[model samples]
Target: MDELLRLDGNAAAGVLGEVFSFEATTAEYACGGCGRAGTLGGAVVYEVREMGVIVRCPGCDNALIRLAHNRNRHVVDLRGTTSFTTG
Candidate 1:
């Protein structure tokens, strides 16, 4: 993804706040695909539809996180990453 189109993870803090009790953008993620590790603030994020977001690895473009709200329900997927941790 183009650098200019990428929004800082903080920009999604409002939406992420709804799902995580702690601050999510500050969480660390280890990419399973490329062995890249960093805070979510440095990941590549794709805003999907009107109610969803996808977080990808900045190094390998692997889809590491997925979040969606639909039909009054919230869905979160993190299968692509090796680990997602907050400390």
Candidate 2:
């Protein structure tokens, strides 16, 4: 008998795509109060615009004045978790 092992990068990437759908531009800012790098966590959502996606920090709940526009090829639509399998 032989054991079967499976690995799929595409599938993993697809899952990741659904999670992180937004793209960040070259503009990076640190929190003036907390001095924390990178964006905040929690249910952080944004709208895509010509200038950029208007985002807010989940940590401080501060509205980002401006963010450059960038492209994220890994955007995926994950409305439901029906595709996922659980044991």
Candidate 3:
């Protein structure tokens, strides 16, 4: 159960890159909830099955991003993040 819930960000890189136009899994993220910063590759990824993917801050365990796809639309919610930048 736990194994299915936790995976490295690399697992979702392809899907994330498609939405960001860049390699998002290698990007850096600052958590709005804790102000802690970490690379997306270091973050934990939670797969919501066919729904989408959830990325959490490795330092604070706060959700940093949520990505979902519906039909031809890609939905991305970043309320959990204060800032994101690529290295």
Candidate 4:
């Protein structure tokens, strides 16, 4: 779990790309059920062609519903960041 959280966006993208067999970008994900927000860190991959992207939420390991489809793009841009620790 720590390893999953530690993976950077690009690295996570690559892994998701391989899993889903489609190019993917790292996006910030929030749990629709719990409202927990963070970078995706699990292994499940979901591709929504209609949305033109895939979504995975680390909190619930589920797809995130777009709050603002046009305003904040789905991709969670954590370009030059590191780990997000929790207590």
Candidate 5:
């Protein structure tokens, strides 16, 4: 990925807020690939207008989350993460 195109997970806060009830960006997460734990705001984010947002683990470059909207609903995929927790 280009350095100019890279953005932190905070960039997805707006979209995440639409899907989650709380402040999703502050949620904790673990990467399935590297087992590194961190807050959502620490991950890498790539926003694609056509495909929505993709959040990746900073430690291992593993894709930890994917968010999108379609059919008047929000779509979230967390299969790439080992665990997710929020308080």
Candidate 6:
């Protein structure tokens, strides 16, 4: 598909907040590749309808977070992140 659709990080904030029990957009995440820390709200988020969401670091463009769904469960991976702070 030549057309690429996307949405801002804030668009997923509500769904993420439901899973985290906090305002996910306000949570700070440190990128493992760049060591830059920023609120998740600032990350670039790409939504893949057939799979899930991919969150990338704003500084180095490294994939910081990924959310996917399997059979009957949802999975979240933060391997690209070194640390995370939730308030």
Q: Point to the candidate with the largest lDDT.
A: 5
Instruction: Residues 13-38, candidate 5: write the lDDT tens digits.
Output: 99888988999889999999999999
lDDT per residue as tens, model 1, 1-87:
332245666666777888899888899989989999898888877776566888888788898888889988779999988988994
Q: Superpose all Cα atoms of candidate 4 onto the true structure and report the RMSD in Å to 1 decimal.
A: 11.4
Across 1-87, the per-residue lDDT of candidate 3 in tens digits comes to 643467898888888988888888778888998999888988899987767889998877888999988997889999999999987
Model 4 spans > 4 angstroms off: 1-27, 40-44, 47-52, 65-87
Deviation (Å) of 14 in candidate 2: 17
lDDT per residue, candidate 6, 1-87, as tens digits?
523346777777855764688898888999999999998988888887766778888889898888876775668899999998995
Which scores greater on lDDT, model 1 or model 2?
A: 1
Model 4 steric clash pairs: 27-76, 28-76
lDDT of 4 by residue, 1-87 (tens): 222232223444643443344444434444654566564444244443333333445555444422112433433332222332321
Clashing pairs in 1: none
Q: What tens-digit string does per-residue lDDT give for candidate 2 at 27-74?
A: 244544344445222213353433333334445644433233337533
Each candidate structure's count of clashing pairs: 0, 0, 0, 2, 0, 0
Locate the minimum summed-lDDT window of 10 residues in model 5: 1-10
lDDT of 1 at 9: 63
Error of 6 at 18 (Å): 3.7
Give the Cα error of residue 57 in candidate 4, in Å.
1.1
Give the Cα-based TM-score of candidate 6 against the true structure: 0.86
Model 3 TM-score on a 0 to 1 scale: 0.88
Sorted by lDDT (best first), the order is 5, 3, 6, 1, 4, 2
Query: How do the predictions measure up, each by TM-score?
Result: 0.85, 0.29, 0.88, 0.28, 0.88, 0.86
